[model samples]
Target: MKNTLSPSFSRRSFIKTSALAGGGMLIGFNLFQACKPEAKPPVDISQLNFNDFNAFIKIADNGMVTIFSPNPEIGQGVKTSMPMIIAEELDVSWDNVHVVQGALDTKNFTRQVAGGSQSIRFGWESLRQTGATARQMLINAAAAKWGVDASSCKTENGTIINANGDKLSYGEVVKEAAALEVPENVTLKDPKDFNIIGTDASNVDIDKIITGKPLFGLDYKEEGMAYAVVLRPPAFGKKLESYDDAATKAISGVQDVVRFGDKVAVLAKDTWTAMKGKKALEATWTSDSKLENTEAHDKILTDLLNGKEFKTMRADGDVKKAFAAADQVIERTYESPFLPHNCMEPMNFFADVTEEKVRLVGPIQTPAGTARRVAELLEREAEDVSVEMTRMGGGFGRRLYGDFALEAAEISKLAKRPVKVVYSREDDMTAGIYRPSIKYRISASVKDGKITGYHLKEASINSNMYGLIPNFFPAGAIENYQVDVAAYDSKITTGAWRAPYTNFLSFAEQSFFDELAEILEVDRIKLRLDLLQKVKGTTDERIQYSPERLENVIKVAVEKSGWGNAKEGVYQGFSAYYCHNTHVAEVAEVELENDVPVVKKVTCIVDCGIVVNPLGAKNQIEGGVIDGVGHAMYGDLSFKDGEPQSKNFDKYRLIRINETPIVETHFIENGLSPTGLGEPTLPPAGAAVANAIKAAKGIRLYKQPFIKHMKAKAPLG
Candidate 1:
């Protein structure tokens, strides 16, 4: 692995030269060496067990080139963005380049799973270096033929040009470049000279999306593919007593019925037939299971929140003393229910099983993790199991949990035939993993109209949103703070959903700050600016934000939203959050309509280090904001007697076009290392909307399904 933190080249240089190459393509180069490279075994350009990969620029004898990617794109715009990165680095015309999905051969490709908004961020450095590295080799090969110094040569549009105007096409020089030992420490262009990196170019994959090409996992098809669906226990721990498969087999189109463990699966020739067969089974399940319903789970979490001495995720300073010294102390508790990802395409997988090996292909976030699990389940060598990732309908952390894929593999193993397990909308929603419900208790003190301290205790099912603690947030924001966390381990399973804990933390933290400003009689914007200033560069050993960067976004959002100014009857709320190396600030304009708070508009300023693709990044932020809004105010997954109450979109609400607010986005133009935008922007939105509602209604809400909390308190019709 190469050192990711080194600084070798700036992005500006690549942009300048890219423009001079005639603006036909945009390439992003990530200079990993941070310095000149030392001779080493040329990066293993071999196709092997890898998940994230950018294939070698394959130039045919006819001058056509193809750029292969192993990352599955699910509309977060990886298809458009990643190809741009590769084309930019290769100095190839975007028109002449064909981008395609790579095979799941780990020895040959990176697992093509896309989530965490990391599609572009991961490729930003390597793709550029790969292009630069290959271009230099080609230049050297062409220069050797002309008896000229390579320094006098420039590459343009897949051809090498010497000072004397002599040129050779890349296709003509590849043989020589291939024979030469890969060069060491090739120089990269300066950011000031860049033409492509900072420029706005159209996404390369837009055409495919518009035409509805087979670009996603749901679109994948194989010959002799049997459709199957698993009927698992209603809740997490409920087990099967017995099943009457006789009726299921009588259903038309039903092929075979197989029992693995706690559940049975019905296989058929198509999705509709398999689903019909499943309903016909009407299998009996034991009620003596330990799955807790929503109400019971809520009671357990609420009880835990009322207790003291929880496990601490972080603690600093004497929080007890700080709260004691204040003349007034404010405490608030907030809660959010579980949510489903509901990726548009639903969950499905195709697998071919044999006695010696298993080949599984579907939309998954972690290909290596899936392969490992499949290997274990099949009792086969890990090397014998292979996974090919398809463009997911949506990930949002749902794909991170491989239950759907596992179910497919288990069915394929038992049926002794290649099978594709497809989940109907209802099955996917009810059987899906969820974002854990959480309860947060926040306390802060104010002394004579000045802020003093803040303390938080959070109760949830897991420590991190995605089960991975990157320390990307807590370590960067807040000061003199204490964070205590306690989890309620239940049969209900959870996994990372987009921003994960950042979503809830931002809502809790930012909303509380807005309330704190109210208590201090300070402007919300100014209060955040002041708090940000205190921690910007203090060596106080408690600050984690880039004060200047955070402050810049705060200012931008304020200016765009016309903050510090007022309009009667129209309320505005502001919130900012930093995570995944990106800082986002948003201001929501809101009003109460029909006794329900409605969001009118939201203006956002996002700084994700350096944006690899402006259009794609914008789409991601917009989508994430809308997603957060729906989850905070509308989305709720509940249960009764341990059975999920909400089965599909009809019951589980989603934010539709009519509900989507007018969103205007601005980017913070700082030439910093690019961070992920996928899940970062989601955290601040719930809080921003919550704050807006407070301004609109003069009341604070501490629970999600925000409208319900509001309606319950208002007079009945």
Candidate 2:
């Protein structure tokens, strides 16, 4: 693999650069060679130079510093967050730097993905060191010119200050700095001295977004870009059998009709023409491909869980003995249905392909995966394909799969011209690889106010939970805890959603824990605190997660929310979880009106190490909490005879502005490595809201969207 510079300034002073990378353009660029999908190894520290640092910063003679953000900007604001790390260490003012979204150049960039909230955490030190590396180079240049010791020189706000107070702008020293050798090890500023890391920084794209810029996938255009729409099978596991395009060809703008495997694409000069052509076309398929229904699917899962055999993922002590000796055993089943991402912008991509190389531009979460998939199809090396990332309206986790990107490449290759493949909102919703439907059968035994046994068995259709995270809570706390999983295969497409398995499971598990707290007649927070105390007290070094960290955040959340006391009528529920290496605790306030739960407010406390950008982090926390609450209250997707029932926004429900509640957020300052905020804040919200509903309505809810149960209950008096 190619050698990229690590921020570690050990005793050696060498940085590697590939062909097109220069000192001004390449610092902080992660140049990595291709490897297996599941493997990650550091770049060789030797064979290094400044020429190929992957070009994150470019200093013109005019001092216009353009920093290229490597990851995709899918509305999570990595375009601003990632660069802040670099600019902070480089000692440059935010006003002096201009950020550019970097295109997918695998040879020069690694980990350009935008999902899982990993951008900041992964690049935190590397980018900072890169900025530091540049600052040192500029200092070295100034010191040589002034004939002074480098230690006497200090850099600030893109200029070098010599002992005599003479200053040299970074632009004036760019050429000289480019020729200097990098230092072996430079000192990083302590967190207490940070000016940008903990301060408030808004999203840099706000102005462009508000004024309606062409940064989104749908707004992308090329000189000869034609619009193509794919007509997928009506149901899962079905394929196109025959088609009559006589009426389709009659459309004025329709150019050609072609088929790729199970999909047919109608090419037109514009999206409207292609859409119209698609409607006019006549197609037929097998009478029945894979018939799917909610009842049968749910039954299959339940049947699987009843069997004794299960892929036991985690097991502590002997659950049998603990349960057998228990004072009482309580069990409850909770469920959540499949939900679509429903991003503001539908799936779309633009690609230009030729035999030698392929160029792609669009919004995607995993550009490396997209490049790899496209390269695999074209039978070319990964470096031969370049994918450009654009700002997305939203990603959730749908963009993790490169199918939409692959579709664009295929269309571009076939048409032999630049083509933009677009999916209408209807197409996006109906032809979905949705979040897997989940079921939880939770049972616990209580013995004299101390838990004797805890059992959790989760069942799902199609996808087995890939995370299989060993670090889930209660792992190190309970002695006889057991976690099992069962999957019943189906034809429906199931993949990652925002928080994936944890999203629905948290609703079930957290609420179930709340129920157990009542059964044991213990305070909900106390029950969790008791478990956490067990973890912290344990001497085992192999504990899956940090018990000390979990306890700290939970304590802060309780203090900040005033959990036990509420203003007269408002009822509150609390939940906390750790994911993506970040811990979050949330409290939801609810009041019932006309038999419906109205979430009046939600307060969140997050501990993601040192807050990188407080304002941006809070925005993420607020958005994630609201999103989880909305899904728990009203979101659901189902199918009949293998065809989706909700086709568009007119039929599907989304959380509106009026539906948003007052969100108050607070962050814990630990000055540790910053973790991500994109996903961790979302996992606990569903359960917090569900538990609050149970308290207000005087009824326990085991079903998601809690709206499903409201219909059966009479209106509130």
Candidate 3:
């Protein structure tokens, strides 16, 4: 049977529904579905033994709140931040909350995909209502016990108090609350009365992480779990012709060598033995013409970018007329290279498969997709496969794909035993689902310091980004606007990385806007703000984002960073973009150290609406800036003859602590719904740094890895 996923519910609709399941006063919710159980009787609360909530919150007899963080924690701090929303509304202290990782229950949860920074944005209200409903139930129970009016009693800090000053701990009243009916309507807390949210609450896993606890996907273990490794094709467009596994089977500790289509797996007692057996396979592949090198790919991409009318994602007022009548027509092409997720923990998953059912455990961004894919590969019902999420060392869009988890399931089924498939750093890097290489052509027709028309063409692998407007910024801000997408197919596996298209696209678009400012003799920040001014109060139906929010962040970034005034020895660049429903404006300050650009500081202003976790939000912005800067300066992944040239960290680099700059983060709180913190913070950072480099070096670096274009003869500011 094909798996069907339910769509995410908006804030208002989510709170209007409730699923009261399990024994205690439990409120269950899922990103994809409401609380759904699989052929089990409703849990009884009379026993006082409590476990397993509906889909999210499980209230224990001791009043222990186990909030299931539905999204994967690829170090984005969702496991801690999400539960805060629930706890705050539950009238409970943060210290009283115990967070748990949620699993794949597509039948219940709406969707479990972790990428795109949808955790907070999607769960903002569902969780709050889950908590509020429970609080109401608890209050009702206490009111019934005292035979007082329900409104006469109130809850605070996990307790219920009556008007007569009689008090009861939530733990003492939870049993009675479990027996009461779930309230339909709950009064949410006023923003001014919030306790756990909008404050620095330490990550629930902080102590576990600091103490080096085994909580990550890499550390997942199960009884009698054998180790497995796969020998994938060395290059793209190649298929495994044959494999000699006899030598692999002869090795000590090697359990079996099983070939599965384009790949072969080596099963052993341990990881080291499995790796050795995999190496011994010596798999051969059929070599064909390959998609070779960045330069070659660039040529193909350029043709695709400019060669055709292609899919016009968006078109505003007469773009042709505006461009034809322009005083200055400017066009710039930007190339963003392929980037690896390079997660600290390489891809790995543990699968226990039998004739009737399969169970999986590991770190993955998308549990629902994993279960669905594994069920398909195993030729079983989706309900027969269960996937449990573990802590991820890093996702960055890498975990969003479920291929690694599927590979583990296949090996487990063939071996007929529980097995853990581990990918060595080299294997994970070479076995690619890398971020697609992209070429963007941004052009505008300006007349007297005003952009009369705009056009953007993007050529990339697989599908394009989410349409032209709403997902793409600066849309609606111009009258004559047009955006087109074209594609160039390749054998290379490509998937979302970090912010997906926005990660690379933002840098290119923002850099071009900076160039536009340069030619027009205007402030880069002011130019963007000016465009936003045109966006104000637009009645256009395509406008999904609030221009006021965008304008606010830009204004804050300028005011807070002191736009025109530069710090000593620093040249500043400004960029603002809105994506993932979050608005961000960034100012990057740079200095030339030994003729190389060194990012000295970055001041970012965000308008993600209400601030959920202040410090955590700051951390997300800081991490994103470092990640974007590191990529802009050095992140490059390319293929030569369909083979990945950079296989490990030694070859594919990441930002180090020594290279990290001071990041100042601020948020605009306009009392709107909370948006995502993870990805929106990342999209504009690269562009901010790229523009800063141009100001510092007196040259526009069109391509990524600005260092690659540096010349020794050029004078640095």
Candidate 4:
């Protein structure tokens, strides 16, 4: 595949070059251009002496290159892949290039977030420009020395060669390149000429990660730092009324107990002592709102879906008329329970707050926003606070909230010393920001064996789906389409979890389409292909998905999975979805054992444009698929009187190694800019499994944690 899009350099992007203190060349460039009108051109590189750009590439006198990646890394492989983009355009040898995580600089960097799986997508052009511009400067420097036109010089493996067959190492021209002017524009390599990209590369930190290095947040420590454990309200809709920490202070190794807001933190010399101190403290809580339960939530959501009040997100045609004229109508409701992030490393952060400055170190997904929030909480300037990011064991949107970081800062300020706040597995699960429980009611009016009218109503806890989601998929496929949303705001905190609303929505919609296919007496894959054909060349600007790309992935999945030709006793399910700027399709193969459906394999096909690193890309795809399968099969979180019923793995169920299926991954090698892969592969797994189960056993599941339904069936043995 070859990329057809031409690289367009932003007029506002500026580059600066300087000499390193140890005799090296440093090139810094801003990948994001300012939104304002074009500013004056940057000063000549000969006069610049500071490093103020968003990303940097430093070449040592020994010809070794170090590229700084300026994004939060949450195990999505941006730390390894982002630098590949820069190194690819720099024309540097992969063996000599080093990658490092850059600190948060709000003024210099933009979109340093890690949630959207967009690190590579958004940085593709600017990062390439940064490297290409530097390569041009080096070529110009060598050309000047050789007394030849810059066009006559070519670079290969970090060496510049002129028409005369003479070569000079990049180290030989480092000083001269540092003196040249920053090029306003540079030509990028065509996709066909890519050497470093579209190839397998090992993770930059794999050696350290495998050898038990101190790379995660929990491994961070500082001299004189106190370990703190906080006791929060036991349940939602409750507040701290009073507390007595006399017993906590009496425990050995206990330093002090400090109260901030509605929570109390027990600071001690070590984590065990802090935990012991927290357990010894006596506290009383009072409920300010009705105690919520899973049953109550279900009732409320169902009521909201049945009610008349709803915010119409998107309405294309007269759905009422279409429904009235239909020969048959199909309606089904899909429900899911709240879910905790369950990050492998729990939540922990180290903070040192003094009168002059505040320092924070943690494995956070949103460093810039967290820094700003922390500064605001402490009534200090944002610039006065600095954040250092560590590699996270697992984020899955859990690390996006900095409540743990905030608690560390508050405790450090009150204790008059540095402190690290750590959460027990119970604290992490019970008091965590959760994926809101939701119910989706979908209805379609059929006439002449075709879906004529489609209506989808969503009721969730707290927030609703993003405004643009209604424009995806079926919105354009059906002429009479309508989407409405309602929410029941609760005291329980809820926010982004992996793919957000689409995670469950994909399963619901995809399963509904499967059922729809059964009623229409049509092939499941053919139904989706025909609907996508209706969305081709749509002029609707609000539609964010590409029908052509989706169709391609679906076709690839069908071909790779051998959709209709599985071996005897093997049943298959298919699902396709578009989210996070990527299109994905999955086929799940299941086998029956004693009347229970067991997933055996999953085939995933993705259209995420160019693959930066095949090795890392496959890791993400397989991980996403397995995660999706596990959550859909056995993951569930219930509540009783506003308290989570499952806080630890003892009661909570996670997919074990024995239960995991073999995942076969494939990608459509389109030459377009890459899209996110971390999340796009997850949303479709649930539906694929559900559909496969339905094929294996003549039963349909309309709720999550499909295990419950599977258990209800009588065993054939």
Number of the predicted model whose TM-score against the real structure is largest: 4
Give the better candidate number (3 or 4) by lDDT: 4
Off by over 4 Å in 1: 1-54, 108-113, 199-205, 462-479, 539-544, 566-568, 715-717
- Ranking of candidates on TM-score, top first: 4, 2, 3, 1
Displacement of residue 3 (Cα, Å) in model 1 is: 16
| Residue-level lDDT tens digits of model 1 in 385-498 | 887767667778788778778888889988989998888888888785888888888887777776666677777865433322223333334444677777877667777777
How well is each residue in 638-705 modelled by candidate 4, as lDDT tens digits? 99888899999999999999889999999898798888888999999999999999998887989989
Pick the lDDT winner: 4
Off by over 4 Å in 3: 1-48, 51-54, 466-471, 711-717
Question: In candidate 1, what residue range of length 10 has the lowest lDDT sum?
Answer: 21-30
Task: Name the TM-score of candidate 1.
Answer: 0.89
- lDDT of candidate 3? 0.77
Query: What lDDT tens digits, residue by residue, belong to model 3 across residues 606-659?
Result: 888888888778888888888888888888888888899999888887778898
Clashes of each: 39, 9, 7, 0
> What TM-score, over all chains together, does every model reach?
0.89, 0.92, 0.92, 0.93
Predicted candidate 2 versus true structure: per-residue lDDT over 1-717, tens digit per residue: 212344443322333321112111111221121122323224222322222222576665555466777677777766667777778878887765666666766555566676677777777766777777777888888899889999999988888999899999887787888787667666777777778778887677665566575668898898777899989898775668999999999999998887888788899999999999999889988746459888877888788778775788878898889889888999988777889999999999988898888999888888888889998987778877988777788889998897888998988788887788999998899787799887778888877778888888878887567423544787788889888888878788889999775788777778988998898888999889889888876766656557788887789878888988888778898898888778888899998776578899988888888887788888888889989988888898888888888989887877888988888998888778888788887889988988888788777888887776665564544
The deviation in Å at residue 452 for candidate 3 is 0.8
lDDT of each: 0.72, 0.78, 0.77, 0.84
Model 2, position 391: C-alpha lDDT score: 78
The parts of candidate 2 lying over 4 Å away from their true place are 1-54, 288-290, 466-468, 537-544, 713-717
